[model samples]
Target: MKKLLVITVFLVAASAFLFGATYRIGLSLSTLNNPFFVTLRDGALQAAAGLGVEVIVADGRDNPAKQLGDIEDFVQQKLDLIVINPTDSDAIVTAVEEANKAGIPVITVDRGASGGMVIAHIASDNVAGGMMAGEYVAMLLGGKGNVVELEGIVGTSAARDRGEGFGAAISKYPDIKIVAKQVANFNRAEGLVVMENILQANPNIDAVFAHNDEMALGAIEAIKAAGLLDKIKVVGFDAIDDAVAAVNAGEMAATVAQQPFLMGQLAVVKAFEYLTIGTIYIPVDLQLVTSK
Candidate 1:
């Protein structure tokens, strides 16, 4: 009887040991300063809570080296899975490879990496979003206008693809010339400064299309300061809260709405799914948002 009782206890202990460990996820975001990314983080947190998993978040602050370091740290910690919103898609490959070497699966959200093995990538189609923005802007100008393009971070897939799609659509209208194209690095302050400089070079710009809402807001500041808001229309991507408000107030024209919250939630879901069934690759949706 004593032997039987001991065996039963050992079996229960073994079972508990095998099944009691809670999964941990590492989420690295590009930048929390951007309101869109903040929304993405909140959505991810909500999903993690629902799944009974622990998530440790790291902010890259739009620095590629820092983002890479964050991924390496997660690898060292031996986290169950790592989700990265890469600051620079090309620069993040080595870090993702390191995680792969550690036998940890990786998931990229929002912006994807240029290389490396990812269990799944969950994000909106940025190219399509960009095309939509271009078409809308062209229509606003009646297919002929002097336009300024405020670009995002250089070398990142989001920047490249968005620019590509926008250019493709704008190419249809030869009369609509891109008078000035500058990289604002997806920062509000830089956007303002860049727009101010561009305004000096091309005083009669008809419209502006910024890669993100932050830049759009910055351009609006410059336009307002110069008293050219009535003349120049602005279209921005990422329908952040402020951008939405701006649109309603007639300060901006339109914006492409990427479902960041849904993308975040789905990223977590896919991470969990990969752990369970080895599933990979989840796609999110995007939409064009205009003033109501």
Candidate 2:
């Protein structure tokens, strides 16, 4: 009787050890300064709570080297899964490879890594979103106008894909000319400065398309300061709250909305799924938000 009792207790302990184990996931975001990324982080936290998993979030702060260091820390900690929103597509490959060498699967959210064995990628179709913005801008200008383009960070996949799509769409209309193109690094302050310079250099600007809402908002400020807000239409991507408000107030023409919260939620959920059974790539939806 004593032996049987001991065996029963041991079995219960073993079962608990095997079944009650909690998973730890690491999420490295490019930057939390942007409202869009903040929403993404919140969504990831919410999903982690529901799943009863531990999530260690690291803010890259828009620095590639810092982000790489964060990934190395996660690898050393032996986390089950690592999710990255890369600051630079090409620069993040080394970090992703390091995680892979540690036998820790890596997943990417929003932007992609140029070369890495990412288990799965979760993001919206940025190229399609950019094309949508371009088509809308062309329609607003009756297929003929002088346009300015405010680009995002040069090495980011979001910037490259969006620019490709926008250029492809604009190429269809021969009357529409891109007079000035400048890099704002997806920053509002830089957007204002770049737009101000473009405005000064080119007086016949009819429309502007910015890779992100932050930059678009900046351009709007410059245009407003120059007292040309009514004359020039502005379009932006990421459909952040401020950009949406601008659209509703007739201060901006349109914006392509990507679900950052949903992207974050799925990144966590998918990481958990891959750790358990298996998972596949996920592409979130995008919408063109305009006053109409």
Candidate 3:
């Protein structure tokens, strides 16, 4: 009877620790398929584990409705907080509001919503990265060239800021013209097909500015297959491993490296701080990350 009583006491203590110890946070990613986001997710996972927080993974899959649903579920579950990689800025407003209504903080990563204030917004300087891409290509072509630009998903801040910044940078060199521009939706397959067509149609193209490295690598493949490997220069954003290798091999010119892991880690760190301090740490001015 004595042994039984001790074991029962131990089991009750273990159960209490398990339930009481968890600091649950809900996570919503823009898309689980993107390598950039995968790195970000890894950082969030690591940070949450280190902080003894439970992260409930939710896949947005680049769908605003899906992301909203996931956030609603989190609100219903009464999770501690939320980390959102918004699919669309406008569409994410209500979802962030939902978190706010539940008294749960929302930390945005990679993308920010247009409304419903969040605890923190974690992202790289996408606009500056685009400027770097444009300058690198212009330098490669001696400030005069016909360039084809590969864009990411339209409407999102990443694509819009990158395109606008790159356009502004390239406009400084009047001789450099964007012969063609197309949205590849940030997918490798779309990039390959679109770039192939662009190459066939624009045989006089001098370079390419891909908004992200995946599309840039895809464009490189198409350029090689079309027999324009050495004739065309390619600049991309996000110094992913393959892009770095290509840069070293002379297949790609340069990439604006964004520390995606750091972005995610900061988001998680801020989320925890919001829980404890009820505030965030987003800087008052621009935080830019540019260069290889």
Candidate 4:
């Protein structure tokens, strides 16, 4: 009887030791406070939880240094995987390199890390989204007009790609010139203030292209406040609910929509595959999804 009891106890202990260990995945985000990114977090968490993988989240809150610190923490914890939404691309190189050295797969979600290679990049085609915004605005203005560009966080891929795409598209229409452009840091408040000033100088501005919905909404508010609502057609990227509502209401022209939830889902799914299958993707630009 004693021997049988001991065998049962050993079996239980071994099972606990094997199955109770959680596989931790590091999640580093640009801003936990932002609603769009909040959806990303929720989706990521849900996916990870469904797979019984532990997720360690690090909030950068729009700071590069904080993101680096969070990455370091994940490395120290020896996490199975690391997911990053870099605050700025250039600032995250060292930390991403560290994760690679530690044999942990690094997945870049939405905003990419600057000057570093990662296991996978999961995001909408920001360049295409930008070009879409530009084309939409040009068509809205009947292919020729003076427009102002409300840019996102400078130097990030989204900002650079979107701006470049928009610029390239607008160049096709020689008469459609960008009247003024400056970084609004992807913040609505900054967008409003910047557009308010631009309104003062370029009252005859025919359109406005904001790199993201937050900035576009702000620009719309500023345009209305300055009594130029009907005069300027506004186009923005990232179809946040507010932006879509504005589009439906005819308050703003249109927005290039990015699937934030899908970005999160893909990142989680890819991270799981890399950990389990040891797969390496062929070099191809994997654009997740972006739309109207």
TM-score of each model, in listed order: 0.89, 0.89, 0.86, 0.87
**For residues 98-150, could you state the per-residue lDDT of candidate 1 as single tens digits?**
99999999999888998999877877788998899999999999999999999
Task: Give one digit per residue, the lDDT tens place, for model 2 in 67-184.
Answer: 9999999999999999999999999999999998999999899999999799888888999988998999999999999999999998999999999899999999999999998999
State the C-alpha lDDT per candidate.
Answer: 0.87, 0.89, 0.82, 0.82
Tens digit of lDDT per residue, candidate 4, span 159-235? 98899999999999988989999899989999999999998887889999998889999999999998888888999
lDDT of 1 at 36: 95
Candidate 3 per-residue lDDT, tens place, 84-144, comes to: 9888878899999878887888888877788896867778878887888888878899999
Candidate 3 residue spans exceeding 4 A from truth: 1-22, 281-292
- Sort the candidates on lDDT, descending order: 2, 1, 4, 3
User: In the order shown, what is each candidate's alpha-carbon RMSD?
Assistant: 10.2, 10.0, 9.8, 9.8
Candidate 1 colliding pairs: none
Q: Global lDDT for candidate 3?
A: 0.82
lDDT of 4: 0.82
